[model samples]
Every structure is written in C-alpha cells, then in structure tokens.
Target chain A: MKTLNENAQSVGTILLEIGALLMSSGASTNRTRITMERIARGLGYGIELLITQRALMLTIIEKDQQHFFSRLKRISPHGANFRIVSGISHLSWNVMEQDWTIAQISEEVQRLKALPHYPRLVVLGMVGLAGAGFCRIFGGGYIEMTVAFVATVAGLFVRQEATKAKFNPYLCIFFAAFAASLIAGTAEYLKIGTEPDKALATSVLFLVPGIPLINSVTDLMDGNIQNGMVRAMNGLMIAFSIAMGLLSVKMILNF
Target chain B: MIFLEIITKSFWAGIAAMGFAVLFNVPRRAILSIGMLGAVGGLIKFTVMNFDIGIIFASFLGATAIGIISIQMAHMRNSPPLVFSIPSVIPMVPGMFAYKMMLGLIALTSIENTDDYLQSLISTVNNGAKAMFILISLGTGVAIPMLLSRKESIKKSKFNKKKEVTV
Candidate 1:
C-alpha cells in the first residue's frame, strides 16, 4: 500500500492546487456559479449536486461552512488566483480538522465528481423575464414590477454556476447590456406606459450600488480606516464597470 | 415621437439602473424587483402629473412608496432594510440635474459667454442644490419607516420584559 499512499498524496496535492485556482476565480464581483461547479468537479462531485450543496451551505451560519460556499461563489471570472488558493486552504483546514486521511479526502473528491448536473439556472432566468413581461401586460403597477424584477435578479444571483463560463470581460459586459436591452425593449414594445424615460430608468435600477455602499459605509462607520477606504475604492470600480456597460450601450443608441 | 422618446429613454434608464445594481453586488433578485418597481413608479408618477398634482408631491409619494416596498423586501429577504431600499429608488433619481450642472460648469470654463455666464451658473447651482435636497428628503422619508419599526421593536421588548418580571 505504499503505492496507494503515494497515489493519495498525489491526489491531495492536485486537489489543493485546483482549490487555489478556484479561490482566485471566486473573487469576481458577480457570477461565481461556474468556478464553484468546477471546484466541485475537481473534488470528484457532480456539478448539479455541488450547486445544490453550495446553496444549502450559503444558508448555513457557521463561518467554516459559509466560507466554503463563498469561495465557490467566487468562481466568477473576475476572481483572482490568490482567492481560490485561499479557499482551498480553508477547505484543507476543514479536512484536517475532520482527521480524514489523505486517501479518504481524495476519495471524497472522486465521489463528488461522478454526480449529474442540470442547467436549471439559465432556464430560471428566461422564465423570470417572461413572467415580468406577463406582469407588465396585466396592468401590474410598481409592486408587480418590483416583484418580477427582484425575482429575476434573485434567480440569476442564485445561479452562481454561470460564473465559470469562459472568463471574458467584454463578453460579461455584453451580457449585462443584453439583459438591460431585453428588459427595456420588452417594456417599450409593450407600451408599458407613455413615460419611456421613467420606465427605462426603472428597468436599470437593478444595477445600482449596493454591497460596496454597505461595506464602505460600515467600514467607515466602524473606524476601520484602511479597510473602509479600500472597500469604497472597490465599490467605485464596480460602479465604473456598470457605467461602462450602460454608457457603451447609450453611445451605440446615441443616448 | 413621444412614444419613441419614451421607449428610448426607458431603455437607457433600465440600463443605468441594472448596471448600478450589479455593480453594488445587491442580490440579483432584489435588483430585478427594484428596477422594475422603480421604472413603474417613474412612469406612473409622470403620467399622474396630468391630473395637476405638484411634481414634488408626486415625486415624494412615488419615492415613499418605493421605500416602503423596499422595506418589505428587506423583511422578506432577512437582509438590512436599506439593502433593497437604496437600489429600488435609484431609477427616479435626478441624474439629469447633476449632468446639467456639470455641463454648465464645463461651458463656463471652456468659453466666454460673458453676459449669460453668471446667470446660467447661478441657475445650474440652484438646480443641483434643489436636486440634492430632493434626494435628502427622499432618504429621510425612507429612514422614518425603518426608524419607526425599530421604535416599535423596542417597545415590544420592554413589554416582554415587564411580563417576564410579573410572571
């Protein structure tokens, strides 16, 4: 079993490296769904099962449990390599704490890899958009609109599995713009109302400053001098990206 | 022509709102709901003005409704109240006012419209200030509901304590 021992050791090292890559990928601002799935695959689990597990993990309160899934969530294209490595380290610690043998851990990874995955996330997005359109038709006012929009956004946010798609910034921006255009185009086509300006403004409201605002405000309030400033800067970058997406479209449309 | 303008304008507005929400890392669901709500609110308010209600009152009421909606969202999501409220109300924000002020500043610095400059500058600043006040009032209005809810919670907690002592 010296051979078995060596094989287990090799698997552990490889898994750890993969985990590191995942952590870096996880740092992306949005859509970490793909990276997490890959990480689950690397650990030897099916993609779909991993996503469900990750979702449940998010609903957990313990730092360790939540941290594992958060790292998976970071699979968005914007994630840095270091972040994935950090996440792998976090998971490794969990393994170590559990007193599992290297072979056992490797076996666990292998087991996870064999599960089947379904692409419900994308379907959810399409369905949600369609539902919003329907709501608009029924003369649904602000409340219905808000519910539909929020539900659509929440559905996308939850999918996080899409984050692992080939990491291309230009493509990401395009998708962002495309989503906005669809929302705007649908509402406009339906003649949701005569006030197109207001409707357009409302449709895009989903992209406003949120986490950064909260993080920056909290850090600043708590007197975490350096941390607060850094968070604020990060928040600004996110806003900049959003502006880039909108402005690009606006220029194309001559707005 | 007005119909075309409405569509184009709403499209841009949607892009702006969606972009901002994504940037902020607000949950996608919350963003979608707020975006749609804000758009509807903007449309409804604009339409209602034909009935002769003052613009300020209309704006305040619309914004307040959004605030209340967001608060309900926060409760449903188990997130902080502002998480949903802040982003939800953004579509109705006076971005044009801010844009105009900047444009006026640029014009003053770039050329000599000597006769018209002071008056325009003053007007630009006045408009910007007014917009800022509107935002402040909206923010205050949003906070009042949250604050009142907190006060209610405090009273409930105190009442529970008294009951505990008596028991």
Candidate 2:
C-alpha cells in the first residue's frame, strides 16, 4: 500500500531518472525537457525542469493539486548514444497515448539502457574502412588509403583500451589521436605514398566530435545558451586534445 | 565518367556514415537507411561543388536534403529526426579543414620570421573559419527543414479551423 507521499516521491524519482538518462545519452536539453514533461503530464503531473551540462534540476507537481516534489540529479557526463535517445522518444509517445505504470516505465528504461553495442571487430573494421574512405575523399591513392586504414585501426584500438581502463575521457581521445598520427606519420617519414600527409590528416578524424558540434549549434539556435556553450566548449576541448596529439607526432617526425 | 566518380565517392561516403552511425549507437534497424541517406548527401554535395559552389554552401545543401528526408522518415519510423540526420551529415564534416587549422596553429608557435608568421596566421584563420562556417551551415541547414514543415502544418491547421467555422 503506497501513500500519496510515496506515490509522489516515486513519480519524482522516475522523472529524474528519465531526465538523467536523456541528458547522459546525448539528448539536447530541449528534447530532454520535452520528453520529461510529456511523461510527467501522462502521469497527471506538471513539471518544471532546469538543465545544466553536468546536472538537471526538476520539480514535479500533481495536476490541479498541491502535492509536489523537487529534486536534482547530477549527470556524470554525456556519451552520445542515439539509440537510447530514439528509444526514449518512442516510449514517451507510447506513454502519451496509453496508460503505463511507473514500474513498467522503469523496466523499459532499463531495457533501453542495456541495449548491446555492435561487436568490437565489426566496429573496428568499419571504422577502418571509413578512414580509408576519408583518404579517398581527400584524393589519396590506394597506398595512402591503406596506410590510413591501418593507422585508424591502431588508433581506435588504443582509444578503446584507454576507455576500458577508465582513463580520463579527453586523455583517451588524445592517446587515440597520438597513436593514429604516429602510424600515419611513419608513412610520411618513409615517403611511402603519394599523399601520406593527407592520410595523416584524415586518419585522426574519427575523434572529430561531430554530434557535439552539431548539437551545440542546435542548442544555441534553440536558445539553450548555457548547454550550448557547454557543449561547444566540450567539442572544442576534444578537438584541441586531438590537435595536441597530432602536434606531438608532427614534432617527433617533422611531418 | 563523372557519373562513375560520383557513384564511387558517394559509396565510400555511405560507408563513412555507417561507421559513424555505429559509433554513436544509432538504432540497429536504421543503420542501412542512415548509410543510404549519407550517400545521397554526399552525392548532392559533390554535384553542387562541381558547379563552382564553395564547400560550405555545398555542405548546406547536402545537410538540408538530409534534414528534410530524415524528418519525413522519422514520421514513418516513430523516432526523432536527429537520430537519422546527425549521422547522415557525417560525410560532409570538415575534418580535414580542422586538421589543417590545427597544423597552422602549431606552425605559428614555431614562428621563424615575419613572413612565416603571417603565413601561419593566414593558414590558421582560413582553415579555422572555414571549418566553423561549414559546421554552422550544416547545423542551420538541418534545422531549416524542420522549421519550414512546422509552418506548413500550422497553416494547414488554420485552414482546417476556417472550414470548421464555415460549416
């Protein structure tokens, strides 16, 4: 038997949980707010939410009633996983159209979060192919593309290992970039290919922070200045770390 | 000959987008479509650039195509358009320019002479601004399609309201 207070607390906690999941899974602030609001409304509550880069502030009040709960959840850091973003979106629509218990929603959230990633070999192979494709787009020859492929694979392997070891996130990117450019720069040093410099340039691109840069602009345009700036700074810092890695290789190889 | 070139380049572009889609953990069901959309975007950008368009403008055109298509696709799939559009635009990202910008900045630190310094500054600014503008164009282009459709829907709803009033 749940008291009204217990119900209210549960609802508030679920909203916070959903909000945290959205924020940490690369959703824009506006989307997170809208999704949380939609779910809260479906549960007969009104919500006021404030989103920051590292945390969310939320208040849930019962509809046409005085009962309300407020809490804040700190998001560890965002890692982009659009699959979760899409799953939550679909769930929100379902909630809007059909009645769902708090427990059911919690179960679904766990399911979505537990979705498996692509196999490691497949990911590594495909990204390597992407690197070679990038080399081709940049007018590199087959030798250059091959060199880019190998370099990119090696670099990504380093990044994956660093991340698995729970190293700092930016440090992982730096290490990956350093490994990639070092491999590519060797081609430049040995004068092995027609466009080794281009290969070197393109091989480090897997760490470009594409989603963050785009989302930063999207957030800015949507008037989420705080989150936008945070995301922009985040993207720029990652790019800078990559640059630092490349600089290290360039200074070492004079390429 | 040009057709084959476009096909080849766009094919690689699709592969690039697929890789990124996987990287971002876009849903499994949507990966192929994301790749197709990315190839189409590459085709558009490459074709536009052939007509003497700048890279920034070409990329905007490509991104707008992605935005409109992805938004419509979202209705059919019951998911947000961002999931589709973000990876689709990966092929058009200015990664090379960003790398060049970084290289230029590095060169600036080594400052050999006035001429060398100026060259480094120019290279850095040129590549950096180009990268920034390309990214901006892509973001705005993707947004424009959604904005345009919203207005259309509003107008249709207003027209429906008028009909109801007349009845």
Candidate 3:
C-alpha cells in the first residue's frame, strides 16, 4: 500500500493529466473543474481547482494535510472528441458512485486517453457530405451541391494533411478555405453550377467555429468571464483567418 | 410549396448535423439523436422565418430548441450536453454572413472613388453587424437552457451543496 503522500501525488498527477486532456479537447472551464473535483472527491479528498487558458492549479486536502499540485499546460485547442470527453466523464462518475480503487481509475483514464479518433478519410468524407448538405439547404442546385461536395473534400484533405504536418491551426484553416474556394471558383468559371455563389459559401462551412462560439458563451454565462473572452477571441481570430483565406481566392479570380 | 421547402431544408440540416457529429467524433450511438435535434431546430427556424420574423429571431428560436433538446438528451444518454448541442448547432451557423462581410471589406479596399468606398464600407458594416448579432443570439439562446440545467444539477448534487456551504 502506498503512503498517503504517495497516493496524493499519484492522484494529483492523474487529475492534472485529465484536466489537460479536457482543456486541450475544448471543454469549458466549468466542465474541467467539475470533472476534476468529482475525481478528487471519489478519492476521499476535497480539492480546490483553478483553471485558466494557460495553467491549472489544484489543491487537495486529505486527513488535515494539504497537497498542492500546479501544472503548466498550454492550451492548444484542437478537434473535439466527445467520445473521450464522455468516456472520462462516465469514468469519473463511476469512480464517484462506485467503490473503485485508485489504480483502477488511473488505468481507465489511461485507456480513455489512448482512444483513437476516427480515420482521416472518414472525417473528410463526412465533412464533404456536410458541405453538400449545407449547399442544398441554402438552395443550391444539384450541380452546385456536387461541386460543393468535391470542393469540401479537397479542402478537408488539405486540412488533414496540414494538421498531420503539425501546422498552426490558423494556417491550416486558411489553406483549407483557400483550396475549397479555389475549387468552387473554378466550378463557377466553368458554369458547372447555377448557384456557384451558394456552393462557394457552403463549401467552407466546415471552418465555422460553431462549437467554440457556443462554448465561449456557455463559459461566460457560467461566470468564467476571462476564459470566455479568451475563447471568444480565439474563435473570432479563426473566423478571420477563414475569411482571409476565402477572400484571397476571390481576389485572384477577380470574382 | 413553403412547407415543402421547410421540410427539405430541415432534412438537409439533419444530414449536415450528422456529418458534423461524425466530424467532431461524437459517440456513434448519439449521432442519430443529435441529427434529430438539428432537424427540429432547423424546422423551427425555417417555420418562424416563413412568418416574416427576422433571421436573428429565427436563429434564436432554433438554437433554443436545440439547447432544450440537448439538455434532455444529456440526461437520457448520461453524457455531457455539449456532446449533442455543439454539432446540432453547427447547421445554423451564419457562415454566409461572415463571407459577405469579408467580401464587403475586400470591395471597400479595392474601390478607388470615395462614393464607392463608402458604399462598400456601409455594406461591410451591415454584414458584420448582422453576423455579430446572429452569433450573439445563437450564444444566448443556447446558454439559457444550459445555464438552467446546470443550476438544477448543482442543486441535486449533494457534494456540490456541501462544497458551497464550506466555501
């Protein structure tokens, strides 16, 4: 059996890892805090956690002894994987509700952290379908829908490649939008679609910061004003990058 | 014809939402429900717009519908509300307005005559404001239901209650 301090150190490390995963995965501050608290509570200790866009501070008090763990984790916002999030969530809930040992919980966390995301080709296909769907909803003709689908697939492929190359997210989005808009513009120039404008617009819909914007507002509403502002600004910057990318293609085409 | 348009739009919106669900890597089991939520939200927005309501108001109602449904889905599925809500809301994002705003800005810069510049500037501002307002409304609409549900959860959790008392 580990000593109390040893157990505390291990728990703190696991909690910090979980918190970093949550933050990097685009979870709001409240979700991160609540989940960490739940895990600490499950370990028969109470914790005070402070989370920001840059770092996490956790203080756990057990048996009248105070243990402080501070982790410096830069939040590099990335794709959302609800599977890992909900998996960790369920694990924490189970820990709180069941009689699970510390080792078991840690093992589960590791397993969840290692869960693989969907393949790149699958994601690309879905995003292309989504673009086509948006085009149709926005009143694009069948031809325009087809063009949008092809454009979005090409764009998302570029995005995936850029991401795998570890390019900055803004640059990735910019290139992706550039590629998509270029294809859509070519389609328009060829008169392949009656609603080329609609196709062009919808083909880049995948870049919209829908989840981040909502998360920002939810954070603000929940009273994490500073983090909310940071997230909102980040989302706005991404939107600007996407616009810049699309505009570059339009300028080149003089359309 | 109008009703048919709404149906088609909603159907497409559902497909879009499902695609987003897959993009976000939401759990396979929750994809269908998220798609249904997006469809309901899109239907509400389309129907309300047919009544001549402004797009902002239409987006608000649609997002609210999504928010409420997401909360219910979260409870039923034992998952976080964000899992369902985020993808469902993607179908209603104002991507076109943002694009138009950028176009206006580009036009504003390229124009030589003052009159043309001012015209482009006005259009730019209009599109930007509309986009911002729509985004704000979407945020507020989703936040309301989420905030309410969060409060209820806090009240129900005894650990949180004790923590509150201590703090």
Off by over 4 Å in 1: A1-255, B1-23, B28-36, B47-57, B150-167
Native-referenced TM-scores of chain A, all candidate models:
0.43, 0.95, 0.94
| Tens digits of per-residue lDDT for model 2, A131-211 | 998888777889999999999999999999999899999999999999999999998999998768888988998888888
Which ten residues in a row are the worst by lDDT in model 3 chain A? Answer: A67-76
Residue B104, model 2: Cα distance from true site in angstroms: 2.1
- DockQ (0 to 1) for model 1: 0.06
Query: Candidate order by DockQ, highest to lowest?
Result: 3, 2, 1
DockQ, all models: 0.06, 0.46, 0.47
Judged by DockQ, which candidate is best?
3
Q: How well is each residue in A47-89 modelled by candidate 3, as lDDT tens digits?
A: 8777888688777676556555454545555688788788887
lDDT of 1 by residue, A64-90 (tens): 232121222322224222222223333
Best by TM-score: 2
Q: How many residue pairs clash in each candidate?
A: 54, 0, 0
Q: What's the i-RMS of each model?
A: 11.4, 5.1, 4.1
TM-score quality measure for candidate 1:
0.39
Candidate 1 per-residue lDDT, tens place, B1-167, comes to: 65544444344344444444443344444556656655655555454544687555555666666666665554454333444555445555544344345445555675667668888889779756755455544544444553455542211332132321210
